[model samples]
Target chain A: MLPEPAVAAGKATRGWIDPRVRLAAALVYSGATAVWQKPESIAAALGFALGLAVFFRLAPGPVLRRLFAVNGLLALLWLILPFSLPGETLLQLGPLAASREGLLLALRITLKSNALLLALLALVAPLPFPSAGHALHRLGVPGKFVQLLLLTWRYLALLEQEFGRLRRAAALRGFRPRTDLHTYRTFAWLLGMLLVRAVDRAERVRRAMLCRGFQGVFFSLQEFRLNGRSLGFAAAVAAAVAACAVLEFGG
Target chain B: MHISEGVLSGPVLLAGAALAAAGTGVGLKKLAPDQIARTAMLAGAFFVASLVHVPLGPTSVHLLLNGLVGLLLGWPAFPAILVGLILQAVFFQFGGLTALGVNTLIMALPAVIGYGLFSRFLKGPRAGALAAAFGCGFLAVLLGGVVAGLALTFSGEHFLNVALALILAHLPVMILEGGMTALCVGFLRRVQPGLLPGRPSVEVR
Candidate 1:
C-alpha cells in the first residue's frame, strides 16, 4: 500500500491558515526563491522556509526525509557541475579542476532547491489534497482542469490498489522480475490490463454519474472565504517574499 | 525526467509556463464534458503505473509510459500529465511547485508528439503496430530527456555537461520503455483495440 497522506498524519498540528492563503504563499515564496541569485537573499529565504516549517508544526523527521529526497539530484549536480564548469580553479583533482564559479552555482542551486522544497512541505503539504484542488478552482484555475485534478486524486488510490493486486497475482504466479525481455513484456501486459480495466470502469462511472443527472460542474458544500486573519497571513507572506526580492535586487 | 525546482532560470521557467498553458488550453478545449471521467481515470492509472519499478542490469527504473498516455489520449495527455505531476508534487514531493511547468512540458510534449507520429500505425499490421509503439515509447523518453537538457542548458551555459549527461543517462530507459510499449500495445491490440485512440468500438471482439 502507498504511504498515508502526509496531511492526514500531520492533521493534528495543522495550522488554521486558509488553504487558499497557504497555496498563494507557497507559490510566492517558491517563485521568489527561484529567481533569487544572491547568496545572502537565498540563505535568508531558506531560513524563512525553516521558520515557516516550524510555525506549521511539520514533524522534523518527515521534513528532513523529504529534503533528503529532493537533494538526490542536487547531489548529482554537485558532482558534475563543480568539475565541468569552466572558471577560475578552486581545487585540482588530477586533470579535473573544480571551478570557483561552478562551485558557487552548485551551492546556490542546493540552497535554492532546499528553500523551495521546504516552503512547499510547510505551506502546501498541510492542506488536504481535495481542498487544494478546490482552492485552485477558487483562484481562477479553469473548472474543467480542477475537476480533472479532483477526479484523478479520487481514483489514484483505487488504481494503486488495483495495480498492487495485479502485481501480487503475478508474484504468486512465479513472476520474479529480472533483466530480461520476459520481465519487461510481463510488466507491459500487466499495465496494459490495468489500462483496459480502467477504461471499462470509466464507462461504468460515466453511466453512474449520468444516472444521477450529473452536470459539467461539481458542487461542494464547504466554502472558503478569505477572513481577516487569512488576509493578514497573506500580507505577512507577501512582505517576507518582498524582503527577499529586495535583498536580491535592491541597491 | 523532472528538472528539480530552483535550477531553471527565470526566462526558461517563464517560457515553459507559457507553452504549457497554451498546450493545456488546447487540450482542455479538445476534452469534452463527457470524457472527463475517462480522462481522469486513465490519468490515475498512468500515475500508478509510473510508480512501477522494472529491473535493469543492477538497478531499477520506474516506467514513464508517456508514449502510451499520448497514444491513448492525444492532446488531452497535456492536462492528464499536468494533473499527474501536480499529484506527484503534492503527495511524494519528487518535483516542486516552481518547476511544474517545465516538468509538464518535458513529459507531455513528447507524449503528444508520440501520439501524432504513431497512432495511425497502430491499426496496421501487427509488426508495424508494435514497431510504431516501440518508436513512440523510445522517442517519448528520448525527447523528454532532450527537452529537459535544453531547459537546463538554457538556464545556464554551465549546465551543458549536465544536460548531455542527462540525455545520455536516458538511453537505457528508452530501450526499456520502447520494448515495454511494443508489448503493451500488442496486448491491447489483441484484447481491447477499442481502448486505442481513433479505433472503433466495433474492433473490440
Candidate 2:
C-alpha cells in the first residue's frame, strides 16, 4: 500500500490555533521568502522557519523527509549553478569553476526552499486539509477551488489503496518493473483499469450524495472563529515576514 | 518538472499565475455538480501518479500521466492539476507554494493541449486508439518539458539547454508513458469505452 496520507498531521493539530491563521502565515512566509534575494535575509528566514518547526512540535523525521524530497533539485542546482555562472571564482573543481554569482544563486535556492518548506510543515502540516479548505473558502478562495481541493484530498488515499491492491495482484503474477514493453503495457492497463474503477466509484459517490439530499455545496459542521491566539500567530508571521523584508532591504 | 519556489522572477511568477488562474477558471466553470465527484477522483489519480513507479533501466521514474487525465477530463485538468500540486506541495513538498501557479501551468496546459489533439484521434475510425494514446502521452510530456524549460529561461537559465535537459531526462519516461497510455487506451477501448472521452452516454457504473 501507499504511504500514509500527508494531511495525517492535521489530526494532532486541533486546539492549537485557527487553521486560517496558520494558512495565511504560510502564504505570507512563503511569499516573503520568494521575494528574498539576499543571503542574510534568506538565512534569517531559514532560521525563523526552523524555529517555527520546533515550536510546532514537528518531528525531525518528517522535516528531514520533506528536505530530502526536494534536495535532489537543490543538489542539481548546486552542481550546475556554480559552474554556469560568470563571476570571480569562489572555488574550482578540476577544470570546472564556481563563480561568486552562481554560488550565491545556488545558496539562495537552498536557503529559500528549506525555509519555505519548514514554514509550511509547521504551519499547514497540522491543519486538517478540510479545515484548510474551509479556511481558504473563508479567505475568499473560489468555492469551486476549495471544493476541488477537499475532494482531491478526500479520495487520494482511497484511490491509492485500490491501486495498491492492483499492484499486489500484478506482483503476485510475477510482475517486476523493468524497462521493457511488457512492463509498460502492464502498467498502462493498470492505470487504465484504475481510472475505470475510479470512474465507477465516482458515480456511486454521487448517487450516495444524491440519496442523502446532497446539494452542490459540501457543508461542514465545524465552526471557524479567530481569537486572541490566532491574532498573536498572525502578528508573529508579520514579524518574521518583516524581518525577512528588513534583511532584504537593510542588507 | 515541478518548478520550486523562489526560482523565477516576480514578473514571470505573476504571468504564470495569471495564465493558470484563467485556465483553471475555464476548467472549473465547465465542471458540473454531478461531475464534481468524478473530477475529484481523477484529481486523486493525478496525486498518486508520482507515488506509483516502475523501474526504468538504471533508475526508476514515477508516472506523470497528465495527458491521460487531460484526455479524459478536458478543461478540468487545469483545476485538477492545480489542486494536485497544492496537495503535493503542502504534504509532499515537491513543488513550492509560491511557484505553484507556474508548476500548475507547466503540467496542466499540456494536458489541455493533449485533449485537443488526441481526443479526436481516439474516436476517429481510421486512427488507431493506440497511436493516439501514444501521441497524447509522448507529446504531452514533450510539451510539458518544453514549457517548463521555457519557464526556467525566465530566471535566466538557457532555454535550449534547460529544455533539452528536461526532455532528455524524461525521454525514457516519455516512451514508457507512451506505451502505457496506449495500453490504457486499448484496455479502456475494450472494457469501459463509455468512460473515455467522445462517448455520448457517460457510463452509469
Candidate 3:
C-alpha cells in the first residue's frame, strides 16, 4: 500500500480574513449577485469580486485555467443569447438577427458568472480542499457532508494513479480509443476494472481504520479562530455588497 | 453541462438548493455505516472521471456517469455527486459555490431516476441489462441537461435561447453515455458480476 501521501496544503496567508469568514462572505456576496438584476449592479458586483480576487493574491495562471473551463457554457450563451432575445435588432448574422436587449442580457450573465467565479476563486481556491472542508464544518454544515468531501479529496490522487496504470496496460495491449464498438468496449471494461479495484481497496482500508479505532466523527488538530481583523473584513464586504444592491436598484 | 454561477436567479437557486438538501437528507438516512467507504470510493472515481473527456461535435465533453453511480448505489448517489461537484467547484471552478445546490440537483436527480430504472431492469437477462444500462446512461445526462435548461429558462425573461442551446448541446453526450454505459454493463457483467444486481448464479466473463 502507498504511504499516506504528504499532499502539501496551500500556503497559509497570515493577516488574511479567516477562511470561515471568507466562506460566509462569499456565500452572501454570491447570493446578492444572484438576486440583483440591474445590469449595473451586476457589473459592480463583478468589480467587487475582482478586487477580492486581487487581494487574495491569486496567480493569473491558475485563474485563467479556471476561466477557460467555465467559458464553454459562456460560449454557448454568447452564441444563443445574442440572436434569440427580443428587442430592437442590433445586427444580422445570416438568418439570425442579434437583438440589443439580448446582447445586454448576455453581458449581464457574463459579468455575474465571471464575478462570482472570481469571488469563489479568491474565497475557496486559496485553501486546500481539506481546509475548505474545515471551513464548511465550522459553518455548521453537516459533519457527514464534510467528511465525504474530505475522504473524496484524500483518495482522489490514489485513484487517479490506479486509473493511469490501467490505461497504460490497455495501451500496451494496443487498445486505442476511436469511434467504434471496439474502442467503446475497451474503455468501458477498463473503467469497470478500475471500479472493482477501487472498491476492493476501499474495503481493505475501511477494515484497517476500524481496527485502528476510526470513528464516524473527524477531529482536527488545527482550529480556526476569528479575530477582530477578520470580523472587520466581513463587515466591510457586507457593506459593499449592500451598497451595490441599493445603488443598482434604487439609484 | 454544469451551469456556472450567477446565471440562475435567486428563486431558481433557492429551489435547487432546497431540493438538493432534501435529497441529501434522505441519502444520509438511507446510507449504512458499512457503505460509507464504498460511497467515498465511488465519489472519488466520479470526481476524477471528469478528467476523461469524449469528443462531441465541435467541442469535447467529459463523462459524468451519474447514471452508473446511481444504478449501483441508489440514494447515496446524491451525496456522492454533491461531493464530486464541490471538488470540481473548488478545483476547476466549473461551477460556483452558490450554484452548488442547483448543480447537485441537476446532476443527481437524474441519477436517482436512473437508479430506479436500472434496479428494476438490470437483473433480468444479458440483453436486458445492456439495454437498461444504455438507457440509464443516455437519459441520465439528457434529463439532467433538460432540468438545468428549464431552470435557466424560468430564471430570467430572455433565456429561451440558453435553454435551447443547453438541451441541444447535451444531445450528443446522451448518445455517447448510452453506448458507454451499455459497454460498461457488459464488461462488469462478465468480470465483477457481483457489483451488478442480479442472481448469484451466472456465467463467467
Candidate No. with top TM-score: 1
Ranking by DockQ: 1, 2, 3
Displacement of the residue A4 alpha carbon in candidate 1, Å: 3.6
The fnat scores of all predictions, in order, read 0.88, 0.74, 0.65
The sequence of per-residue lDDT tens digits that candidate 3 reaches over residues A173-237 is 88766666776677777788888887898799789878988777666655788989999989989
Report residue A184 deviation for candidate 3 (angstroms): 0.4
Interface RMSD for each of the candidates: 1.3, 1.9, 3.9
Q: RMSD to native for every prediction?
A: 1.7, 2.6, 3.3
Highest DockQ among the candidates is held by which one?
1
lDDT of 3: 0.79
Score each candidate by Cα lDDT: 0.87, 0.81, 0.79
lDDT of 3 by residue, B92-197 (tens): 6667788899999888999999988676666567788889999999989988988888888889756676578778977878888888888887787777777775
Better of 1 and 3 by DockQ: 1
Give the clashing residue pairs of candidate 2, or none.
none
Question: What TM-score does candidate 1 get on C-alpha atoms?
Answer: 0.96
The residue pairs in collision within model 3 are none
For candidate 1, lDDT tens digit of each residue in A32-97?
A: 788899998999899998888887778878777777777876898789888878889989988999
DockQ of 2: 0.66
Clashes of 1: 0
* Residue-level lDDT tens digits of model 2 in A123-234: 8766766878998888778887787788778888899988889989999999988888788778878887888888899999989989999788766566888999889878
What value does the lDDT take at residue A72 in candidate 2? 70
Docking class of 2: medium
